[model samples]
Target: MKIPIAIVGCGGMGGRHLLGLKELASSDMNNITLSAVCDLRRDNAEHLADDAEELLGSRPLVFDDMKRMAEAMPDLQAVDITTDARAHHLVASTALDLGLHVLCEKPLALTIRGCNRILTAQKRSGKYLSVAENYRRDPMSRLTKALLDAGSIGRPELFMDISASSGNQIIITPWRHKKNMGGMLLDGGVHNADMMLYYLGDIDQVYARIALWEKTRYRPEGDGAVSGFYQRWFGEMPESIEATAEDTLTAVVNFNNGTMGQWTQSYAAHGRGFGHKVIYGSAGSLRPGGTRNGAPPVLAHDGQDEITGSPLLDLVPDFHLDAITSNLFGADRLASYDIPFPAADRKLLAIELYELAACVLNGTSPEVDGFVGRRAEALCYAAFESSVLNRPVSLDEIESEQVGSYEAEINEELKL
Candidate 1:
């Protein structure tokens, strides 16, 4: 049965989701119909509905309110929430309370308490809750996990996920710079947290120093400036805006499995920027590719040329993408793909949407379910807690709210 679904929050990510829906429809795994698009902004909702019509050959009903959309469409089985970070818990709790499955975007909620609120609602409603974590679904991520599991990267010793960007410009949206709104760390760092968990394992503790290096951010000067996939931002923007969120962090994380790594990210590095996700094992080292870039993993031995591209596939002969993911991207056993930007983004999101549909249809768990998402989010919080305490903080303490000085303000604002 095709599940009737609605997409909440018709903004940039929402538009990309429409593209994802189109890609899902093209694949054999498609199982959901875009019945509606909901957003507080009527113009945004209508605009995305128009794009949906052009892409999917039919326009979805537009709503300025989610409750109105739900009341209007009794058949709505689920919702894909692409709303901003702060609204995730509210929308997800409401959707679950309404007896509908939910696929919420990353950082599940702004704080652990907020995440617990949604989790509590899901428990009460007994509806499926899937976190829209697309990074782990990438082929490179899948193969990397396989190689590590298969001992290709024997006894993984150290994993490093380092990223440094130099810019005072607005990152996608203005709200992202606000601490109460999840900020750059929670909004962007959740991906890194998830990738770390996916590549290594559960994090035990984190010692971190967090800072806000760039307090003032500037918006793009002219129209046609791109932020993410396609032209996400256009027209005139504010000259400058004050940022409250911490933009820089350097942390040493200890994994539960005896592995350790550093997670350093900054938006205030002025001179130069670099990024990499490489794990060094006893036997060799493997560097995985980006989430949406479709680049292949690079494997290096002591005296061997780095193996990547098609040859990288040979390292993990038993590695393969699942049938659904394989068909969605038109690749199954291949190590790397060359799918371009919008398509790559769409395909990954489609995989998320399809997983939500599959769970609703088949009673299976999602690859990135609520608990997994909560853990990824909690790791970020752990870093913040560590920063505030000036000491290493355990994941248990962070998850249990025992150590929450950093999140106290956000939790107070949210009152969750």
Candidate 2:
């Protein structure tokens, strides 16, 4: 019996899920089906439906409205939501309430209150809800986890992560510019923050500073670029847009395990170097490569030898679009190759799919559940609070009705 899956928001991320599900279906590892898909645009939904039908040999129901799709396909066991951060709460809450397991894209919500609402919905429904914090599941990241567990770095004492962009050329959807939709920190830094939490433990306190870059340019009113053809089709002259949200943020976080950590994210840096994270301990250090569109290097510090060493960890092959097609249609059924996606973003997509599959088959909630999502979102809020007040904000200062229970669970998980 294949688990029937539905996807909402047929954007790039949504299309990626459809592709992954099609691959999984062809693998026949676990019985899974793409039962339905929904998007706000009829054309986008139809395009995905065409792809799904060609790949799966069974057409999935496509609807412009998610609610209509859910009603039409009552057997939908799980849904992958790739909508904007602002709509995450509404879409995820509806899916969970309807007894469908949900895998929502990152940030969880723009506001802490929105995150809490999703958590409340999850608790009430008792349905599985997982955020697509995929960086934690990347092959290299997995290796980092294994090394950390194996004590590659002895007692991770100090951690630093730096993420700088050469001015993001985002195709401006209005929601992206809106602070309520979760600006840069909530939109981009959520992944950075989540990865930090995964490597280090829970944060005890946060102190931060935020700044907006005044030089970036964008059209005042136009849809964002599709590919590299922004200037060709839109004909909208780029004008210096006032950055209402922070373009750069630097924060110091105190982890519960007494590790001092610092993270910096900037969208204004030039010269094209990717972001990097280095975890240091008394004995050795581990530094993972930047988030550029290339193979990431996971290097370990050998304190005994007093040098950094790169072990011959097998590099996962990069599967092209043809490989994706073959994996779906089975012209040449190669053994399931564990190819690594380029960066954390794609790996996060894979984890979301796996979590949805798990929820459908095993009836267990995802490891990164709604509550965990809220915790991450709350940390972002705390960072903002710390910046505004010019003081470190303790995790305890963020008031949630469920904070007591949340802290207890976190404490138990950390064995603190």
Best by TM-score: 1
Candidate 1, 29-49: lDDT as tens digits: 789899999999898899899
RMSD of each predicted structure: 1.5, 7.6
| TM-score of each predicted structure versus truth | 0.97, 0.80
Go through the candidates in order and give each one's C-alpha lDDT.
0.87, 0.65
User: Lowest-lDDT window of 10 residues in candidate 1?
Assistant: 228-237
Pairs clashing in candidate 2? 134-348, 171-224
> Candidate 2: deviation at residue 359, Å?
2.2
lDDT of 2 by residue, 235-349 (tens): 4334444455666789998999888988888876667857767888866787753332223435456645432223413222222223322333232222122444432243345
TM-score of 1: 0.97
Worst 10 residues of 2 by lDDT: 312-321
